[model samples]
Target: MVAVAAALALGTNAGAQLYSTPAEVTANPLVKGFTVSGLTLSQGQTRVTLDLAGGRLVGLLVQGQGAQEVARGLVLAWGGEEKNVADLARSLGAEEVKAQARTAQGFAEDSEGTVLRLKVTGSGNAERWSAYTSLLIHPDSAFPTTANAEGNSKAPNVLRVFSDFQCPYCKRMWDTAHRTWAAQPNVYRVVHYHFPLEQHENAEPAAIASECAAAQGKFWPYADQLFSRVEDWVPQPNPTAKFVEYARALKLNVGTFQKCLTSAAPRTAVRAQYAAGLKVDVRGTPSVYLNGVQMQDYSDAEEAALIRTVTAASPSAAQVIEARLKALR
Candidate 1:
């Protein structure tokens, strides 16, 4: 992918562009040549690299030193309510350049997890400004993985999916995509995270109920039931009793399941997972990631091919970054 490099973090939140699939970086016509790098976590000093049109090169996510050191491109996180950038010195790296640029236009997004973008059209000293390159960085996402999953735990391919119980698309993926994928022998393991949206009234309860099912080692089937029969419980103001009935139907210890569902444990677990989703910048339900990289949203045929090729024999994110860094040397 051609890297969409920004020279500096510019402008107020005019109209923050929220990036879902990395494909948007190139597909976008408004911002010329903006793109995301594939490598999620870069090992050594050199993590990410960007090549601009004018032979201007920069690192994206560099870490480490010496024998295996690599250079990463420079990037910054803009616009958050907290307005706090943790680990700025360590994560931003040694080579980060600070400069102000003229922002012609800009983007604004949600206060919690937002992707801010700014457009720069230089008119004055063009030669001096062309040298600096900047890339927007995603908040450090150490994905919170749960015991709920399918397939081999050690498989090379890993699909981390975030979903809400009341989400129809999540049901679509569960019935069509993940149900098929998870059944495959060695393809990939699916790790699920609960992301209960505020808009959905029963979503939080359903998430907690699913966690309760997880306690009894019935998360998958219980989840299937939730999606399969969303109409039954979601309409109700409080689905706690209905959730217990599902536990009974699944032949789980109905007593323990009831206790867990009502207790603080399941609620705490649900909130933690939701916060984790926010950390990874998950804005919508059914957010899926393959091998730590965002799978492109494309046509059914193209997406099928992408799913096959990327998961075929691709290295882990760390391994991929290391191999590329060494190649650069």
Candidate 2:
């Protein structure tokens, strides 16, 4: 592990030090899961840093430049004030917007959560701007989690999908599984798992909020409301508000529901799911695995072929070999 010197926040007049390498930046205690380099903040100054090259913050990269252009754009975006960004901000919720903005252009850590000062550059004068932003990575305790859904007692070969409440692909997969389950009720069991992406800022919180409801014995009802109208909210600017509406639709004790959204344990469990996805190389939504064998695509025909191969201990095993040869050809 690369060692990090205690980093002073940006603008603090703390002693100058060399970061010198990428490994150092990655292992820094102050930095969470983001890239850092090519930027400087004086000691005691706060800023969030990100991997610009990674296309990680494409939404806020200012290809356009003007005096105070970035800062002004941020303020407008932050307050649901800017026409261009407001729709997105409102859809994503103000908190999510701030998270997106703070790390939009790498930020540095300080007494505050990761923060960054917006300044317009490229003009030799290094023109400074005033708009600032902060991104909060809730305490680890705030992530969402799952308590095994009770009826999962159906079978040992069950497959569970902890999916995002707002993801479009999740809906399609749910439908596909529903149809498949109806037909193959004895062959497979489907369980749901929640893995909300960070990019879908509201997703994690909403998932945690739902899981909290689940704790209170309302999870399936809440999930039904979310998935039922998921299509209506797709490509819309604010999926979170729609989720709140779904909560209201379910009459899920609004006060308790909101409290659940902010709860730490639920959030922590949600983050754990995201981390688990990363571990399994799940790059997108609707990823599924069968008995830990990731199911890329197995139609009924393919499944039947495998079942036949397994059940029939043919004396020749020759047909299977010939079939394999034909497939390779």
Candidate 3:
């Protein structure tokens, strides 16, 4: 049996009041195949722990103000694989909860403070087995500010990209998006957010490095270097040295960049961006939002066409004035 400690801290106001306990699992139809084993309400947070027949443990921590959930953390474990879950929870700034018996674990958070439904499935033999944990975070969370954006912020067409440095799909999407954006640089603003998946051990560090480079006005270049050389550093025992090498190559102030890596701010910012992505129901890397609306499964041709449509629909200064005059008529 593996012992795992999951911690989640929701920084509510000092005088925030605790809300009522969450409804029982039976009360929420969205939850299936799990039994609620424990529930607690304290310090403006509600915790629900669930147990499955195969000794799987699932814990949920929620912080709310009045009747609204403002933040939440979901943790799932089976045999002894709580390390990933624990690390993810800590990255998102959640408090710790203890558990035993583990197979594999997953952690997810919500910045919007809304209810989430997840599907948990598992099967095992006498030696070892695995399970699939699905998390559904509500889609009402506010989008985080883009710390690394290319093009004009006030542009009418905006593209928000949620991605992980270690995700191959994200890299593919980046390649496609880069080509498209290069062709129409003034048509849209592209904002990048970090959503590092737990399976990639080096992803978090890469995200931190990108954010650190952003502080020095080189986020795009640093990200390009990291993605271009992902295969080189991902397998290294520690990728920080490689990250430093990239910083030097970018002509960044190495001292300031290295200090940023050790500081909590960059990691914290990455986590916050991840939480925001979850709030908007981002389940995978390369999730894109056009003008605040999620766009799903589009081919590169379709994406380019959509971009052209947005660009065509955008009004020029003279067109804006003409439209205003017509509206006044």
Per-prediction TM-score to the true structure, in the order listed: 0.59, 0.43, 0.51
RMSD of each: 11.8, 20.8, 18.1
Give the top-scoring candidate (TM-score): 1
lDDT of each: 0.53, 0.44, 0.54
lDDT of 1 by residue, 39-127 (tens): 23332222323222112111122233311121111222221111222222232222222112233221212222222221223344331
**Candidate 1 Cα misplacement greater than 4 A, ranges:** 1-141, 298-329
Give Cα distance to truth, residue 318, candidate 3, Å.
25
Candidate order by decreasing lDDT: 3, 1, 2
RMSD of 1: 11.8
Model 1 — TM-score against the truth? 0.59
Model 2 bad stretches (over 4 Å): 1-145, 148-156, 182-187, 231-241, 298-301, 304-329
Query: How many pairs of residues collide in model 2?
Result: 35
Best by lDDT: 3
What digit string (tens of lDDT, one per residue) describes model 2 on residues 101-203? 3353522222222223332333434433233332221221332235634333454344546578678778776566545654565656555566786677556
